[model samples]
Target chain A: MTQVVALSGGIGGAKLALGLQHILPPGELTVAVNTGDDFEHLGLSISPDIDTVLYTLAGLANPELSWGRAGDSWNFMAEIERLGGENWYRLGDKDLALHIERTRRLNAGEKLTGITADFARHFGVLGRVVPMSNDLVRTMVITDEGTLDFQHYFVERRCEPVVKGFAYAGAADARLPAQLQEDLQDPSLQAIVICPSNPWLSIAPILEIPAWREALLEVTAPVIAVSPLVNGQAVKGPITKIMSELQLELSSASIARFYEGIIDGFVIDKSEAHVAPEIAVATHVTGTPMKTPVDKQRLAREVLEFARSFGKL
Target chain B: MTQVVALSGGIGGAKLALGLQHILPPGELTVAVNTGDDFEHLGLSISPDIDTVLYTLAGLANPELSWGRAGDSWNFMAEIERLGGENWYRLGDKDLALHIERTRRLNAGEKLTGITADFARHFGVLGRVVPMSNDLVRTMVITDEGTLDFQHYFVERRCEPVVKGFAYAGAADARLPAQLQEDLQDPSLQAIVICPSNPWLSIAPILEIPAWREALLEVTAPVIAVSPLVNGQAVKGPITKIMSELQLELSSASIARFYEGIIDGFVIDKSEAHVAPEIAVATHVTGTPMKTPVDKQRLAREVLEFARSFGKL
Candidate 1:
């Protein structure tokens, strides 16, 4: 009867979320997705991280790729091109429909939390998928190349810019979504898992909400973080590149240091077992490459077992 | 050297605009498009009237239809269906691109006039396609069913609702686009042609602007109007049905009366020749079935000839 809450962004975060979903009961796992990348494109409210996790968990995500739906068509993007629009973000026809619906619902004054809940129900996702906040919080990456929007730095520019730092626009006043706050305060809550998402770009924005961070710290549950970087290289995204730009060692050790005062435990990939000694909190190693459903389930079970060993229940 | 300003909406309006484009010199024809039907769908600021006129003037309009581009694909709408978005608006992929770019520019604080100017220049439209006003003036149809947003009545519901009347939201504060007013006041201006678009739906909204009607009356140049209704039926859109539901006679003669104080001359289709005696203004018959490029040019020439017959110039 353990209630597990997992924080995630897109891609690497979704991998670990899939694992958690496999091991947790239907109502046990609540996922809080980053909304920093949400922007109005082509008049659609596109929450890239939420969609990626939703697609991944529904078993509809492209098996080879971390983002977008599998077997999706480019008919819509091609047509957008014919109309002389920028197609750098690579929205598939099926994906475009979700964005359109989300945009429509959002414009009609529905909260992002409610929209996410409806979308999860529609997609038949067994676990809850919640946006970090209902407020607009765009991640602004201040790079040596100049201040760039998150998508511009990641998708449009292909993450080639040298990062100076990052700022969460609107995070100063952003409150945790009611659903997320309620989940954090639930009596059944036993653990919080920080998934393998980019520390600064993804998870930091969610944590920046004062109430969100305060609620996590106030909770009695053990907070654990899984490594996105293994053996000095990130599994996906610009985590390692950003780490180097910020003059930090790109390893599980650095990952632990990034969340030093926040997390109670650090989970590293088996390949980076040597760096376990340098990580401060209680650490463990297990199969962390969540390539298949079986791998996801196995990792989920391992994380749960490791949490139980901390003598909470 | 005559500066001709043609006020238009969709389809039939585009046809007359194409004709004007053929007859007028570059920069001589300023086409004021209706923005009453404009609404944000999927976060795209869609100016349907402006796009129709732009595509028509550029020779990119569908030959068989007066709206949208030729060979347009529904990939965007199709994908929107997959994501469970509103499919009623039926945005083609290429059409969505126009909306996306327009929305992007709009969000960036660019004026609707400048965005449209860029779109017109990009599409190779020789005539200027100016929005009636930079402000958002939405047309709301007060129908027997309910008050419906312009697109909700026109596109989504297929204009089936019984019409009571209409009102332009935001018209009280809407001023003429500065450049449009400047062009209208130019000494080279000779005549203003109101294209064969729906009077209540298209033209009424433009006139509803606080000082717009005054401006139209102040200009001494003969203001001519083309009838949308012929033989008691509208060539396109909901003009005939709307007229009948509002207790107005569903004919070209009634159309002239509806525009009574505003116009000095009226152009009717050959099909409406029998009803010429019923019209208040001086009326003439011309081929108004603008189903092709030739039809547009021919109609434009006829309207110009009718204007010249006044003998003031």
Candidate 2:
């Protein structure tokens, strides 16, 4: 009857989140998704990470794209491009329903947490999905070109810009959602799993909110992370390139070092287990690449078992 | 070459507008579409009448529905409904591109006229398609239940409300688009054709603008209207029901009387020619049912020929 909380970003995080959802008992898992990449595009409020988690958990995610809805059409994007609207961030036709409905509810004064919960229920997601905060916390990448919004850098620019640094705009004022706070304080709370998403781009935004880090420190539950890097390369996305641009060591040791003070344990790919001696925390070497549902479930089981080894569960 | 300006609403008006586009030389026909029905739904600015005119003129309109794009898919609406969002308005997947693009440009400080014109050109529409004005002018339908916004009354309520009257919410301050004003004053302007859209819902919103009426009266060109009612029934929409509720006689003569002191000619269906003598304006009884492109062109030719009898063209 252990309750687990997972902090997630987009694709990679969503994969492990899906894994966690499948392996965990009903109502035992809760996901706090990054909203730092949320932006208003073409007048619709688009929450990229939240939608990825929703689609992935609901089993509606496009397997080929690893984002958006399955069996999705591109009529909206094609027509938008024809009309000279920005088409860099592709919005699938069926996927647009989520953005439009979320935007409508947000404009109608509904909180993001409530809206996300409602969407999860509507889509038949087994576990709870909550936004990290109701308030704005945009991730701004200070690149060589200029300060670009997270989506502009990651999607529009295709991560082509050399990263100087990142700033979590509005993080100073953002409060952790009450749901997340209450979950963290629950008596049965056993573990906090940071999924294999980019540390700086995904997990950092959640951690940058001062209260979030403070809350994690206060929790008795063992905080653990699955490394996004395997053999000094990202399993997906631009994490390796970003690490190189920021002049950080491209290794699992670097990831462990990044979360040194917060996490009690780190999960890295078995191929790179040699670097475990340099990690400050307890290290678990496992098969971390989640290509199939079986892979996700297996990793989820391994992570939970690893967390249990800390004498909490 | 004669230049004609047409005032239109949705479906019916779009039919006649399409006919005008076919019969008139390229760039000779300009449509001033009613924006009173424009409302923010799902956070997207939906100019229904403007889009209808654009789709009809561009040959993308559905012959079956006469409103949305041909071969349109309803995945967006279906998904929106599944998500518990509003589905009564029925925005098709392809049609949503127009609304999303327009909403984006409007938020970017572009005029509705410019955006619409750009869309028209993008869609390969030869004739100009512009909104009646760039400013907001919502049509509020006063019913026995209470006042309802145009879309609420027409789409959500299914035109079931007992109509009392209508109020153009922002008509007093709305200015005619510069393009419409310039077109009206051009020496080559020979006629202003009022298409067969519901006078209460469509054309009236455009005509309700005080400056619009004043400018129309000052023009040397003939002002003509195609009757929406035929033989005590509407060719489409709720014209007959609204007329009965408003205590007006259900006849083509009543339509002519509605535009009294504004129009110099009225085109009605030949089936109702017996009531022509009661009309104050010059009545032209012809085959006005535009079911096909050829039919639209024929009606357009006849209406133009009838307008020329005023000695302007």
Candidate 3:
């Protein structure tokens, strides 16, 4: 009966969201998606992270990619290619429609948080979906090569560039959505699960918002973070690589250290269970290899069960 | 070689532009395209008339549709559909690249005319293509149902709406591109030919620019208009249907009467040779059905030959 808030980014986070969606009652779960990776492409405002979470929750996500609509066509992108535009991003025709509608609504003066809420409601999604911020904030990776936009670093350039650090460009000006702020104050807000998303990239931006960290400090619920990195490697994406590039120890201990004072518990992959005793905070180990929907749900349920034990705290 | 300017909209006008391009020496022809049909769709500023003329001139127009790029693909549009976006306008993937790039550049502060000129130049088009006005102007249809945007009437609804009147919403404030105004004043500018495009919907918008009629009147060169309606029928599109809906006669005589003193010569299709004599204007009969590249060139040659006969008039 506890209302759970899951902070998420794109793929890795979406897996956890799908898992949470499976165990939690529809209205009891709220997934707050990162918008720092959102940018305008072909005049359409595209929220990569928000879309990934939406698609995964809607059961329309590509099974292999864990993003975009399954069975999506690329006719629109083919037309774009013929016109000599950027063909690198690979916008599926169906996916382009969402971007178009999102852009249309956004340009018409609708806040992105409201638009995402409406989109989630329209897609028959039972759980609440919220954007991290309504303001325009872009995640930029400060690499040895140069400062690059998140999509450029993640999608276009394939994260090959060495990350020196990352900056959430507009986080200083962003404010937590009113509902998100209110939910943090709710007595029923029993848990805040930071999905095993990339530390510096995904969770960092959410925490970077000027009031976001302060608001999380205000919540009475235990703040738990799941480690995206385990056994000296990332379960997915550039988390471990970025961690190493930033000269941090690439281990569950390092992830805990990264979130040190802010979190009450750290969830690591069962593969890294040996290192659990070394973590400075309370630690829980689970089978976090989310390769399947079943894997995602199992990991999510295990995390929830672990958090419930902390009700004694 | 006498320099000539032709005012045009989509298919029918592209045909005359093709004809004029073939006969005129390099730089002798300037095709001023209608921009009133332009509107922002999915955040991209789409100029239908400008693109149609550009594609037709670039030798990349789809032969079947007589608009968009030749051999165009639809991967992008397919993707859009998969995402549950509007699939009404089939923006070919290849063709979409141009719109996307143009929209990007436009948003970056490039003028519509400059962006179009760059596209034309890059495509190796020799004839100068100028937008009738640099300003944003949209044509709206006041129908029995309601006032609808041009694309809504033309594409989405497939021209099924009953129109009461048409309004060029921004024409009263639109200024003719300075280059075009200077062209009108050039002594070497020998003739002005209005291509056989839809009079009420296409040509009327260009003419509606408050200073346009005066500019046309001040020009010493002969102003000629080609009849889109031949033997009481249009070569393509809703010209006849729309004309009839607005309670106007669908005939070459009506077209001639429509241009009365504004034109010195009226080019009628050979099929409507009988009606040419009724109007008190210099009229010529010619082959105007431009179906192929050769047809476009040949028509351009004939129109030029007819205009050359009145040189220095």
DockQ, each predicted model = 0.31, 0.78, 0.41
Task: Judging by TM-score, tell me the better candidate of 1 and 2.
Answer: 2
Which residue pairs in candidate 2 have backbone atoms (N, alpha carbon, C) closer than 3 angstroms, thus clashing?
none
The whole-model C-alpha lDDT of candidate 1 against the native structure comes to 0.84
Per-residue lDDT tens digits of candidate 1, residues A229-281? 76778877888888989999878898899898888888999888999999899
Question: Model 3 over residues B55-150: C-alpha lDDT tens digits?
Answer: 887777888895787887676676556545677887886677677778888888988778888788877888889999988888999888899999
lDDT of 2 by residue, B69-172 (tens): 89888888878987888778898888999998888889889999999999999999989998998889999999999999999998899889899999998988
TM-score of 1: 0.86
Instruction: Name the DockQ score for candidate 1.
Output: 0.31
- The B-chain TM-score of model 3 reads 0.96
Please write out the lDDT profile of model 1 over residues B1-313, one tens digit for every residue. 4478899988878788889989888989999999998998776688899889888888777776657778776755765665566677777655666776788789889999998998888777889999999998999999989999999999888899999988899999999998888877877787899999989888888989967788899886789999987678887777878878888877788889988999989999888898899988899887788766687788898898888787645
Better of 2 and 3 by lDDT: 2
lDDT of 2 by residue, A1-313 (tens): 3389999999999999999999888888999999999999888999999999999999898888857899998888888888887888899889999998988899899999999999999899999999999999999999999999999898888999999999999998899999999999998998999999999999999999989999999999899999988778887799889889989888999889889899999999988899999999999999899989999999998998898899964
DockQ of candidate model 2: 0.78
TM-scores of all predicted structures: 0.86, 0.96, 0.89
Q: Which stretches of candidate 2 lie over 4 Å from their true place?
A: none
Candidate lDDT values, in order: 0.84, 0.90, 0.82
- Chain B of candidate 2 versus the native chain B: what TM-score? 0.97
lDDT of 3 by residue, A116-141 (tens): 88778767776778999898788999
